[model samples]
Structure formats: structure tokens, C-alpha cells
Target: MDIEAEKARKFRISDFDLIRLLGTGARSSIWEGRDTSTGKSFAIKRTFKQPEDDNRYLDQAINEYEIASRLQHPTIRKVFSLKRVRRVFSIREIHTVMELCLGKTLEEAPPNSLLEKCVVLIEVAKAVHEMNSKGYVHADMKPDNIVVSEKGRVKIIDLGLSCPLGTVKQRIQGTPSYMAPEQLVCWPLDARTDVYNFGATMYWALTGELPPTVVPHQDNSISAHQKSAIPPHIVKPGIPLHLSYLVTDCIKIEPSGRLGGMDAVATRILVIIRELERDQEPTFRIRQRHGTGHGGSFLVSEYRSVAVSERLGPERHVIR
Candidate 1:
């Protein structure tokens, strides 16, 4: 590292070097740092002092470490080490060290990058599937928790709300918009919950708009439960119908109705990639430009979607 970079790396707060502030939440702040002894870059998540809130945040940190430690997927951030420190002022602090993932969150992704978004989502889905197969649920799955690296790889982070399938019902956790309907009602959850959240995440990526908070009972208005049926072309015209349908199926309200699982989602995405590879020509029609008075025509190829699977399989159930 250069002298400036070295100086940047040396800045500290309460003995730990603050390489960079990764993100902040209601209870903690995450920072990028390096272990001086080993010279390895790691992500350090620090929780603030609030005795009453300490146990909650501490439990979350431990859960994150436990879940991540058991997972060895390319799309999941890896935890290297964890530690706790108590200051002379009587404040307890907890820190978790994870492999440094240099990238931006999907929330910060550019709107015009549809193909990029599709590719990233598929990778994340694969990772979530692997986690699910192991009986773990990433209770908090959202754009903010998905990291996009400079090399274009996606890694899911912040497993604070995650828990093994059977234990999640004891805690009502996860973000509002990304939370499944069952989660909102405090019902026991499973891998399908993550599938629903991932589907919503993809919807946000395709439309550049968040899923509607008010779920309409009828087809006249958009409902989160009906998200899997909304075509990308309906929001922004000209996207391939096949792609639009793919996204629609992923967001189905009934977990059983959604694409079979993450592996199924990945398989469908791969089919699209194969078709694109076979024919480099653009297959979908592009919308025409109205006039100078109106905005230029947006590229329809910029968005994608998924279709629902017709076949049925053994339902994966959680004991909770």
C-alpha cells in the first residue's frame, strides 16, 4: 500500500483501526480493517453501548458469526474471527471480523444495468439455496445485505437475523418491505422466506422502484403477493417477455407456487444465458422514441424476469 493508503489504514477508534466505515444501522457500525499482525483485510462490525440493547445486538453478532462460519459459499461473506472488549468506562463492545468484500450494495447499483443485475441475483440465489439445503435461513435478505464486488461477484452479508430453520420462530426479525407475509405475522419461517425476499430484491432491480407497500386485494392494484406475475414490460416497456415472466414466478406469494427453489431459479437463468449465447441478435422489440419533448426511449433489454414452474416436488418443511 502507498503512504497515503497506509496513513488511511492507521486511523483508529478505541484501539481498533477504522479503515473505512462500511455501513451503519440502529445498533451498530461496520468498518473495514486489517489485522496488523497478519496483514489480512477484514470487515469489523462494532456494536455500540446500550446495556439494555447490548444482549440483543450481542446475540445477533453471535448468530451472524455462527451462521457464516458454517457456510462456505462463494456468494456468502466469510467470517474469520470474532472478539469482545470492555472499556474502562464500563461499556461492552463486540466485533466480528469477516473477509473484506469490496463492493457496493444492490441499493447503490445503477438502474440501466439489467443484465448485470440478473447475473448477480442468480449468483445470490445459488448461494441462498446452498444455505437452505443446510437448514439455515437468511431471515434478512435485501438489497442492502447483498454486496456487489468490483469483479462483478455478489456476496450476501449481515446474517444477524439468520437462524437455523427450527429456531427462527422465537424471534421476530427482518426488514419490513423485504419480509415475507408470514414473517410480518410472526409465523415460523423456512428457506422459502429467503426465496420470497430474493424475488422482491430482483423486482426492485428490474423496475428501479420498490414493491408496493399496499397489497391490493384485487388485480387492479399491485400486491406484494402478486409480484411474481407483474411483467417488467408493464413497468418499463420492451423487456423480453420470457425474462419478465421469470421474475414474476420468483415473487409468487405461495412458496409452493414460486419457482421450485433457488436451484430452479438458477437453472432458468442459465437457460436465458444459453439462448442469448446461441443468438447474439436482440430478439425483443424496442419501444420507439416519442419526441424531444419526451424522454429518450429506454432500452427494453435492460430488464429481465422469471417464469413459474408447473411441476411439483416434495415440500421442504421446518420443524418449528
Candidate 2:
């Protein structure tokens, strides 16, 4: 009868009521749906095949469901199942049921404190590492895909671009500002690719500046080379040198030049957190010296800072 009712029926989710539209992308829309029997909420991502469309959107929805459903990490959004409505032999519509992240995306509502931002980044890094460990790469990692709950919990969403490790995509895939150089060159994508994306994200999150990538923002002409990202501490003075170097190292042009993997990224972020928690203004910078092993060694330089969270700003309660 109604549009929501029709969606529920068509998706074979008759026990759930489509409450409202949460977000939209491409030919897909995510709805906040509630289970009638249990009153539990979930995010329902539905995509339709339009007259002018091919099967790209449908394939992406299916890909998201298949990849995300296999991940059980708390920092990653959970996917339940895929539902398809077939018209004759052609599929007309598809739906993916996922965990409803009850807050705004990092792009929409970023945390105020640098420490809090690091916490969020650490969560995402760990989750990405988990995906890599499970033989997948989150080819797309950006602020818009990271949802932060009111209680400060973080959830990484949008697995549509994810692919098996060593996947060399047929076409360039990733947000321009955050796309790794390897992704631009159609090279074999491994955990290092995610490292670059994560680093670019961290760079922007901390300094509010986009890192240099092979693909410029929304430009058709691709750059043949990428310059080093300006260190975060240089862009923003108060940012700790430890973090600044880490961010710079992550966005290195060559995958071999960056950190070993996402696990290393999380470890370095944790070290920064621990140093900041100490609350002492220490004159030292921690630089990750590559080629040592999987875990890079840190070298010291002149730098000083207070606790990141308190120094940056007061932590305000996030209103969902």
C-alpha cells in the first residue's frame, strides 16, 4: 500500500517497518528500519535497477553484504543478509540489512578533541587490520564511512569497495583525496593501501588539510606523481610531533615506504595516546624508522605537548 510497506514486502522483511530514510548514495538509500516483533532497529540499504542503470549498484550492494557479513569486529558495522526482488529472470531490487549506527558520520559530526579523534582512528585502524587478516582490504576508507555513536563508540561502514587482498581493481576505486597511490596506478592492493588511506584520513582529521594523492579532488586529469603530505604538526602547531611523523609516514608515495600495515598504524596511535595521557610536556618526537621489522622503532626529536584531549578542546557530550 504505502512506500515503506511496499519496500518491506518487496525485500521480504515484512516483520520490519521501514521508518525513515537515513542516507542515500548512487542509486541506493539506507533506511532506518525497526523489527516489529522485537522493536530492534537496523539499517536497510536498498538499491534499485533503473532504466538507465546497469548492474554496478546491485553488485556493490551484494558485495557489501557478502564482505561485511563475514566480519565480526565491534568497530566494524555488522551486515545481516541480502534480499533481492527478481522480475522474471532480472533482479530489479536488492536490500542489505546492517547494524544501525545510531549517530552521525565522522564527516558530519567529528569529535572535538585530538585524543578522541585518535581513539576513533585507532578503532578504525584495528578494524581495517582485522579485515586484512580475514583476507580482505577496505579499499574505501574515509570520514564519511566512519560513524561515531553518542557513547563514543566507532563503527566503520561501507564495504562496497572492499576486495580480496592483492586485488588490482579494474578501475580506479576510492575517494580522490584519500586514494592511495597504488590504487591510482591499479597496482596489487594489500594492507599498505589501507594504510595510505587511513593515513590520509588521519592527516585530514588532525590538520584539516587533504593529503597529496595521485588523484586531485574531483579533477579529471590525474597527477603523475604525489608529493609528501605536509606533516600534521607543521600544519597545526599543537599537534604532537609523534603523530605528525606517523601521519606523514603513512601517506608515503610507495607502499614499501609506509608502515608495515594497519596493525602498525594502530600501535603507533596507541603510543601517541599513552604519551599524551602522561600529561607531561616532553621535548621529543617519535619517528617510525622503517626496515627494522613489522613493528617499526621510534626515534626521538625535540617536541612538547600537554594531554591531547584537554589541550585541543573540552570534550562535549555527543548528541545522537
Candidate 3:
């Protein structure tokens, strides 16, 4: 270990109290921590240095910190600090402090309504599009890596597999159900790769089923670049045709055939979100106020149009 980076600090694990283990990776384990001074919750990822023959786990952790530090978006999880710790003379570990996105992973907490699906996908698309603009492809995009907070904030949580655009992944790094065809074959990655992943993620969010990965068809005429997609509308009969079309087009096996760019994909999804918002019928709220409408004093119940989709007290509800 350098003991000193060009700019950053070296600290010990004793600085924070570990609350619970969040998750584990090949070379790193994330723990929910509480800062000693601030007492605020944070997710700390402790990455153990791996030997050369073992995957570059330390480097990947640094890469995640670098990539996450550069991109700043509400839906994109943030890394607050990075520290290096030396447990022994020759052993070093990297600790990444991040915002504690409290909630169940999207894989664990499936969305219940179409509106919820639309809201989640729109935020994810915006964040991914931003990363694409900066030339990074989140090689892994899946429900397991997304946290839908108890307060309803959707955050993209992991970046271990993230790599720069135009970079060809040497190994398969993404989940099978959401992996783009090019990624599996080690093709150069770009914005379209994110589009495919986003499409697959949204497909699962809308329908309870996952998209079939691209595979070589039995006949020689069909190439491995062809994917067998079951439209969301097909699985979930209530899925709108427009959304069904959007999800199918997003997962096109070939890069050229899929939505050309994630920015465009995001825009198209935004349009759908707006349309969905408009389709929601306005709801009225009844407010009680003291007034004298007649000769006698009485309480007046006034009805005013409040809004739709937002929660209303304990009787929280969202339109499907």
C-alpha cells in the first residue's frame, strides 16, 4: 500500500462501529456502519487486496469509488469517503463510505403497481443515462443491485462491475437475465448496452417474469445475437401496448436494433411517465372548517382537488 495516495487519508476500521453486514463480494464485504461522531448511518464496503492471479478486487473497489464519485444524481448512490487501512505489515484493505440506502433490494421487494414500475424505471434510466454521458457503462444492472428505500427512494447501489465505455469486458460480469448480448461476447460497450440492461430490468418490474437471454438459434440462419423476448404485455395482460413496445425494443439482441442510446430511451420513458401521470384522475380532498353558512354556527366541509398518486395519510394509495 502507498500509505498515502496523491490526496486521501488512511484510517483504521476502529473509526466507525459496524452495525450489520450488508452484503459480500469476492473481495469485499459491505457493512452498515454508524459514524462515531455524527452517529449517522453509512454503508461501508471493506475491500481486501487480492493477489494478481485473483481478480483485481482492490482496483475494482477504487474504480467503483472513482466512477461513483464523478456521477452525482439522486437515484445514483453516492460514495462519501474512501479510506485505506493496514491490518498487518503486508495486508491492506480499502474502505468505501457510502450513503445508507435503507430498504429492500428491488429483487426482494417487487413493485406492486404499473405506476411504481414506471417511477422506478424512469429514475434508473436518468441515472444510467448520466453515467453513459460521462463514458461509463455500469456492466452490472439488475434488481439485486437496486435499493428501493423504505421512504420510497430508488437508488442504484453497486458499481463493482462498472467500466469505461469502449472497454471490452474480459470476463462476464453481469446477471444472466439482464446481461446485454454484447457484454456476454466481450464486445466493446457503449450507451446501447445500458439500454438493453434497462429494458430487461423494466420488463421484470412490469411483469413478474424475466426476459430470455440472447442465444444461438437451432438453425444456422439465426445468429447468437438474436434474443427470445416475451413481451411484458404478453405475460401481464394489463400492461399497456406502448410500454410493452418500449420494453421489447429496449432488449433488442443486436446493439443496432435496440434503442440506439440510453438518453433517448430515458426520454421515451419520461414521455410515457407523463402520459401515465395525465391518465390519473384528479382526487378531491375534504377539509373541515368552522363557518356560519346559515343563521346557526356550523362546520363546513369544503371539497378541493388535491392531487393524484401521492400518498394520503395512513390510507396511502397509488394508481395502477
Candidate 4:
């Protein structure tokens, strides 16, 4: 008898009461589970072996647990444990327990304003920086992987593609629209890779559009020839020019051209937010009686625009 198999046989799916199906992936499903012994709730991810996948899905499931469990950050969801089930001599299924994050993904409900989005991305940048400092790269980062709560808390989820810093993958892996150019080929991935993905994510969050990447989106016909992304302000008028420039810099094709690291990215965004808020205030509304009748006149004061282009200075890298 295999020692590991004997140990795993003691734990089974019946140990937890699966309350509801949270979500599903290619060959996996996430469930809201309650531990029968302790009555504690958790998010349980289960992946099953399949003939066509050839253990790819199982590898990812194990990778996700290994990488995520090592990371410790408030904005990053916590992964608790990994369980394997064997049928005789071979493992058949894997389950990972994680913090049951309650919120809608950024894809389902994005922040309503550029300010809100910037704030959310700032938290995300910090979380990724934490991952980098811990010697890991979050290879997959997109709107769908970030969950934002009603009270404005941000939590980064999904680490299946994550790897040790400077790891050269055996094959291309990442979401197409948000993938960095280096990710298209089997290149040595580092913090810069995450920078590109974060920038692409930010570009989409601010402009409601995807940035140009190596793997072109079905709707992005010009992506192949496009050298750089259009400034966010160009795609969306109200986005501050400074904010737009920062996002574009992040998605630069070459790793050296993008923001140096996640820390720099987070600090720069924080500065941008501070400048925007300090220089401008929310639009104010006023009402006055026009003809002294039931019908009254009301007018909303135009939103004041911040001169961020000038305030940001000639050198974009300077945070101050």
C-alpha cells in the first residue's frame, strides 16, 4: 500500500458539506463548503483527471495551492490546504481549500468611476508587489481574478499559473488580452511580466477597452500592427492624461520599458490619485426657482478638470 494514498484515503469529500456551487473552470469547480467537524466555511476547488487534459488541469490545481499558500497579504486571498484522492495506484482528484471571498469579480461589476478604479488598482498593485517580494510572479492577472466588495475591499484570486520569479515556462500561458509580449513565447518571466498584465488590466478598467497584446482579441483587428496602446484618455475622454500615460507605459512591449516593478506602479498610481483629488473636487449641484412655480430650475456645476499633464512634469517616472 502507498503511504501517501493511505493518508489521503482518510480524508474524503464527505468530510465537508458542500453548500452551493460557487463557480466552474475548464475541468474544475469551486464550491462553498462547510467543514463538518469545525463548521467553518471555505471555498473548495476540485479538479478531476481527464484523458484529454493529460494531467494539465491537475498540475495547475497543485501549483495554485503551492504558490498561494506561501503568499501572505491581506489583499491576496488565502489558500489553506491541498488534498489528493487516489484510486488504487493513481491519483484521481485534487481539492484545494481557500478563503471564501465574497464579492463580485471586476468583470461582473467594475467600479463606476475612474477614481474608484484607480483606488482598486492601487490595492492590486500592492498585493502583486507582495508576491514579487516573496519571490513569486502572479502570471495570470485580469479583471476576472480580482474580486471587489461592496465596501471597496479588493482581493486578488487565482494563482494557478504563478511561478517562481525568473522562471521560463515550458509553454505560453496567460489570458490573451492581458498577456505580455514575453508571455506569448516561452520567455523568462519575472516581475515585469506582472507589470504588463497589470497595465493591461488597468487599461481595460479605465477605458472599458483591452490593450494590444501578442495574442490579439477577436475584436482587436489592428492589434497585430499596433505598436503601442492608445492612451486611456483617448479611449475615454474624462480619464486624466497623467493616468493614461502611466497605464500605457506599463504595457510597453519590452520588459525594460514597462514600470520597473509593482511597488513603483502602486506608488505612482497613489500619487496620481492624490494629485487628482487635491486639484479638483466632485461636481456640485445647485437648484433655484426659475418662475416661482411648481417647476423649478436646477443645474449641476461642471466637473473641474485637473491639469495633471502639467502637474506630472516632463519625466513620467518621477512619482512626486
| Candidate 4 lDDT | 0.75
The runs of at least 3 residues in candidate 3 whose Cα sits more than 4 Å from the true structure, single-residue gaps closed, are: 1-12, 49-53, 86-92, 216-227, 282-320
For 151-245, candidate 1 gives per-residue lDDT tens digits of 44568888888887745465557777777655655566777778778877777777766654434344333344444435676987866677778
- Quantify all predictions' global Cα lDDT against the true fold: 0.65, 0.76, 0.72, 0.75
lDDT of 3 by residue, 103-174 (tens): 667787665556556767766777787888888998788888887665556799988778899998777667
- State the lDDT at 50 in candidate 2: 81
State each model's C-alpha RMSD to the native: 9.9, 10.9, 11.3, 10.9
lDDT of 4 by residue, 1-320 (tens): 23343334343476798776666677777777899999999988888886555877899989989888888877888998888888888777998899987667788667565665775787788889889999999989999999864333578989989999999998878889999877777678999999999999999888889976565446522243456788999988988888988998899887888899998888788788677567646442222213321122221122333333322222221101
Stretches off by above 4 angstroms in model 4 are: 1-12, 215-226, 279-320
Quote the positional error of residue 241 for candidate 3 in Å: 0.6
Span of 10 residues, lowest total lDDT, candidate 1: 311-320
- Residue-wise lDDT of candidate 2 within 1-320, one digit each (tens)? 24554456544356679877665676777788998989999988888888788888898888888898888888889988788989989998997888987666778656566765776787788789889999999989999899766444678988999999999888887788998877876779999999988988898889788986565435433353556667889889999888999998898886888998988888788788776657743443334333322123222122333332322222321212
Error of 2 at 273 (Å): 0.4
Q: State the number of backbone clashes in model 4.
A: 0
Q: Model 3: which ten-residue window has the lowest total lDDT?
A: 311-320
Ranking by TM-score: 2, 4, 3, 1
